[model samples]
Target: MTRIRREVLTLPAAELGPDNPLPALRPLDEVHRIDGRERTDLPADMARQLGHEPLRSLLPARVRDGYGRTRAPRALDALVIENDRLRATVLPGLGGRIVSLVHLPTGRELLYRNPVFQPADFALNGAWYSGGIEWNIGATGHTTLSCEPLHAARVPAPDGGEMLRLWEWERLRDLPFQVDLWLPEGSGFLYAGVRIRNPHERPAPVYWWSNIAVPEDRRVLVPAEEAWHFGYERRLSRVPVPSYDGIDRTYPLNSRYAADYFYEVPDGRRRWIAALDADGHGLVQTSTDVLRGRKLFVWGSGPGGRRWQQWLTAPGTGGYCEIQAGLARTQLEHVPLPAQSEVSWLEAYGPLDTPSTGEWTDVVGAAEQRLAAALPRARVDEAYAAWKPYADTEPGTALAAGSGWGALEVLRTGLELPGTPFPESTLGAAQEPWRQLLRTGVLPEPRPGRPPGPTPVSPPWRDLLETAPATAHTEYHLGVAQWHAGDRAQAVRSWERALRRAPEPWPPLRCLAVADQEAGHHERAAERYADAFRDLCRDGHDDDGTRTAAVAALGRETLEALLRVRRTAQARSVWERLPAAVRLRGRFRLLLAELLLAEGRRAEARAVFDAGFEVADLREGAEDVGRLWNRLTDEPLPARYDFRMRPDTG
Candidate 1:
């Protein structure tokens, strides 16, 4: 089909009136653990240096009473870009985020439609939300401009189609960037052509990360499984994903506990990634072959991690998963553009609606076909080359002969691939167990891949350590296996050695922190969490990833450990020192307010509860707090005024 003319509707002021309600959210029980009670307290020093905080202290007090989303409907330049097959809206006033993408034919919203333009603390630049596809430009992590207005206008595509252009830069490191968006007429795909330029005279840094938020109830299919590599605090190791504690990752996301991974896609043929909704509707994302890194983040529908994120970004509406594609391997490893140079590439998002969603071949084959129409096929040798820098592949020597789809079948997959051997280590048999540790941050059940006798540890591990004895990762896992075998003291010693030798020591330190918290070493656990964050920063890993782990551990794990110990004063101190983003989180806000009431600070407590009324996810907390406030004051609760959706005519 030929390209058709596209339409761009401009709204001077968008209105979110009383009849509108957020789209039916995936139920919290789908992912959030309901069996366990929320933690009531935490210690003062929990996950100190490691955390997600605003770049500056000027973030709006997360506890503002009656706070409304910064992206709420108001009189600003509103843009609606549409075609026969797809429709999308861009809020220029709010950093030009796509806001919404709807499949017009089905009347189904493909993107997570956040009814409000709420900005909570998540991005490094301060203020981020959990919906719509976000364009992360400028310095690494979330750009400083995500929360601000951008220069947007409707332009013409070279193919005689219409384009929406968004550009923003506040002289951020002299890095100015521009993105041209196009929705082909009668096409299901949205294409973005981005240009990040070093506007200054001297050599300047360039970075770009494209993040898409998709529904989590379905399944995400990546190229590799066991071969999927992971990195934390800047150190990377190949690992299995979405699985740990014997849980298979292919199950529904919300059912799984919290897990995050920066993984590599090793498939050579498809050169794309996809997420298929339960009903077989799919969202496919692919970038220029050069954008090497891909990441998956899930706030396990389980209890612990969700509590921490809500405190930070307020994962409002419901929890969603992130599919992130970056221009480079990690945020810190930005390329230096030539003086006055500019780099540009294309990224596309399309849809899939096939009869079969459960079958990998059916789903991925469908997505690959649809994607191939707009992109080039992934080449096996080229794909292996991406891993060349990190792997042991030699240019002169050829990869082991054979290929197929998937990780274990990677060698047999037809698209063609290569192998990277690490020294003389026997990592081959121990792949699964090592992957488990990398993906879950916890060790996996010992694989009986070795002789079953006095020593149950896998034998490949022994070979790995033999050749890489000084390696921190090898030592860390040695500790994990020891700990898992009920050798806690020896495990602790192994981790200590791992920490000293590893360049990026967060994982080893994290193990220590968890052990301390579990052993009622609340105070020390808190200190370790903070120290781990510092170690992450010092290790040159992406600061944003470190912050995510820190916040989750400190807010959920460390805080609970402290509170269960009745360290009220210490918890309060932690609450105070927390970035405004964390302090005003729904759960923590409720805790802080309740603590204030218990401390006879009713006025401040009331304000804290009032903030919840403004957020849909936290609305339940608002009601309970109101009841408690009335009880303490011997008066009726104040009436809550919140916006409601006008009824739909469909």
Candidate 2:
């Protein structure tokens, strides 16, 4: 019979608990799952909303939905199971986190087991820990309950093996997911099967990821040539993997670089990845189907990156890297499960004796011997044949070059799928035949600049706003509709209400500020814009794209209004939060200099204006800055001519 042991552990709370300091809930909207109104895709803009906004709700719901501190210095239990081939340790106290994996034959721990329990403010739920394999379900980021305890059970294996099960009933979303891990007799690898169940009648959002932490020994083999990153803006761009920084990233990285990247595997048959030291000993992770996308998180192993390295690792424990595999594609573009549906996946992990050469073929051969897969080799050929129909389509070709996400397949089939972010300025509805030229062609376009999106028909603006006042998105649309409907006062109230519901609800705040700016209330507009930007810094976590979008939407108008009224100090406060990309513009730089002078930062302002842009060549945007310059110092604007229209128009 298989022998599985459980151990209890006591530990201190993370020195830095969740970054969320608020334990008190405000009166925010609680959008209950209306029986017939199963909300799926929340529009592109709402889909982009994340971080602390979803954590705290004003209405009563699941307590866990409100971000809080993890109980510390408490009793915890860990489960241990081993065979002649290997041993595994799971901390049920920490969401059944697999803290250690050891190869019995070599007697070496393959996983980077953290010396002590340490959590951080690194998850969507606001608390996460480093080390071990984190079974991530639902949308991307850490699982909601990763830092919380999970329900654990021992499945008595009748087949000469031991199985351990860890499961969770997710908060708010009401999704239930379970993972079963087993080590069958005569098998050298550990097997795990995960099932995420959606019992609701309406389709629900779903995302899955397996994040495994490995020793930072600088020797790993991921058979990928290219990888893409959507980053904060969700702009898809690809770069060479392994050699991203001129060095094969397969090895340990140096310096202060920190990034999140997604690698798309073209050869569907190759679904396994391995990491080994010079001594031919390490760990291997493989899956049944093609792991469409893999994510690599690396914090440079040097003095420069030490700050972040320390942030992620506990004291005395060496730095570790995450080798994550996502279902179908990167979690940036999550998909929704059909109503009353469920999905299951399998992963095989075990010891690897990779050759020192690190050749792809050699790794594959090793996996074939030590790995047990549920799928047959014939599946690879079948996938190729199915993909043939998209051979001539733009998405297919772009995918071949490793430049797109899972949505490209939807584009190829002409299906209107939810969850994919709408097209940005760079991706307007591509003109048909020409659009057929790439994977980026199918991004749905956002409602150009804001205007209530045709005023909800069935639910109507009043229904959603009155029924779900805590919903930032609902209020945002209503504000726009109210403005267009000539109820400017109501629009202002609606937007302000949205801001209070969620600290940064940038869209509504930007719209409100715009209204004030247009009304010639420059001072009031500057104050609101500045406050919104400040909230972005305080409560906006992992929201680079949101911050960028907010500033881009209102920075110019806000700063212009402030400068026009000589609210230099207020202008400077807002200016600092603008993204580097937008602040570097000549017109913005000129406004910044005038403001700097107002604050008595004359030297800095003079340098900024002097070196910013030649006034002679600034004919297009010279007027605003020129006027500000004259008002501030009684000086004429730089010499510039406008003999013709702008370059873009020409």
Candidate 3:
């Protein structure tokens, strides 16, 4: 592939001229100025102060004319410093690496860039061809297009020396480009366009789109025939997708009148366009002719989060519409593209008087007519009707029901306890007894068998449990209630039953482990905890590894509890069976060393403590580990030292 180069320049436009038709263009300058202000000169004092810190010393200093000076710090040093500061302060602690710069204020950041091509292998090559494009306010109200070669920028050490190259293009026509506009903070209007000419002697096969992402809750109104395609995986599929892998297939779109729509255009078309609802909201349209067809895509951001860029619905979320100009899915095998042929043209007409619809055969014509028409009055009748149910309800019932789950029916049909053989009245009587367990620190006698006599006539719990064996959630809830009611044995049984029927592993594992721990089954509790940790680890839970370490720590605690009862031999045997990963953990190793010392094995204890100190030092990488080693080796404690400081504390 040939390398593609981008030309960067400021847009030349004065303030809106008297003859300009679009009055909304006047605010472009203000929006540009606002965005540019985010890139103001960095404070030199702050940079120097940060440079003195150990962890933050990696931040680079600002360099003036860095490229021409041979020994100067790279331009990327300033960028990295700025980004690191933003990550440590402005953004949540989650760090994001900067990738490409489109403009000073706007660019393609790896973590928070516009959802064009995701940062996949295909995107790496595609992004290089696309270049860094930005649209900002010009001297006039008109927008300017700024472009920069992504590879030209220099990065600092570590990441800087890596050989990252942009995709090469022989001619500019081989590249497809679009202008991205960052919207202002408040409600306003923005427009985007692409001017492409087929410089090739023969028409080039083309597939182009203006992908707009919106929030999940925002409703879209599009014209359709009998049914429209609904994207299952947000923007990829038109039907219900079984998994993320099956997102490529398109299904017939079917949605309420409020659902967004994607219009599929047949191949071999030249020009296509669409408009957005006129309330001065954003809109997007696309035209493509790769498979001898044209496709148009559109959607809106549902109600939530700040709206940033065009088609951006929320801060970190959005949906898309794909307008295709090609043969239908059925006719793909029969269609063939002419060599070196032009594909299609896409145009977006925003700030329309009404919502965009498929009913119009000529969208541009309809858009022009709508633009001439007066803006319609805002209506609240439908909204009022939707909210009428809450107003008409009785105050008592309304107050009692908090939300969807707090409805009267849900309250009346309370949770069911599993493995409990008791009447509703007997269960109710046990509530106070359960509460007494926590206060008095006493365990109730286990029931030998099922309770005597017939089951209670008003046993709502038995009916609910028997009828819905799969109600593991209810079983767990009831177990917690029983634990609080002073029936420790019954709580254990209930949690066991819940684990047997629970669909997922997490809830049941947690309930069972807690029940065993409370029931004085230390070894059994450790086993259950380990099982839960392993299961969660296999399922990609974030805290799985941490939880596994915690389980090992708990096992050590359990051993200490056993030793308190003079079961030293049993504790030693249990400790020997622990997993290697757990045994090497800082807390577990410390406990093991202490346990060896308690057994009067001084030399063995010394060895264990030495190993533990090394592990702790490696894991924590702090001076405290060295101090701990000295203390364990019989060095006198420091006079002012506080032994109670936490291991994790700096």
On lDDT, the stronger of 1 and 2 is 2
Candidates in descending TM-score order: 2, 1, 3
Whole-model alpha-carbon lDDT for candidate 3: 0.29
Which candidate wins on lDDT? 2
State the lDDT at 71 in candidate 2: 36
> What's the TM-score of each model vs. the native?
0.49, 0.53, 0.24
After TM-score superposition, the amount by which residue 44's alpha carbon in candidate 2 deviates from its true location, in angstroms, is 16
- Winning model by TM-score: 2
lDDT of each: 0.50, 0.54, 0.29
- Candidate 2 lDDT over residue span 1-650, tens digit each: 34577776666544432222111122122111112121233334324422212322211111122222233575556787777776888877566688888877778888877765555435554446778888876544666567665655565443535466666555434456666666666556666766666755677666678888887774666656677643322334567755655566666563234445667566655676666777767887776563455777665553323544454545576777777787745555455678877766667677777463445546545545543343333433342343222221221000001112212222433433221111222222212321332333221223332211222211122443444434565566566556644567987887888777753455566667768866878777777766655555453333324334344435655676676677877777778877686576554666677778778877787677567452211221113454455545545444331112112211
TM-score of 3: 0.24
By summed lDDT, the worst window of 10 consecutive residues in model 1 runs over: 19-28
lDDT over C-alpha atoms for residue 116 of model 1: 45
Across 1-650, the per-residue lDDT of candidate 1 in tens digits comes to 22222234332222221210110101111111111122112111211211212122111111111222433334444566677877777766566677677777888777766554455434443345557788876554565456555655445564455566665443334345556667755667777776665534577656667877777766776654542322221223445654544654544354334444555566353345666676767677776666666767665554433553344333354656777777654443355678766666667676766433445555556666655654444422332233223221222222111111023222211222121212212234424544444344444433221111111132333334334434566676566555544567876887899889766666677678867864778778767765654454342232323343244334544455455556666556556655566455455665676667666778887777556533323431123444456546755444342111111100
Question: Mind sharing the TM-score for model 1?
Answer: 0.49
Q: Which candidate would rank higher by TM-score, 1 or 3?
A: 1
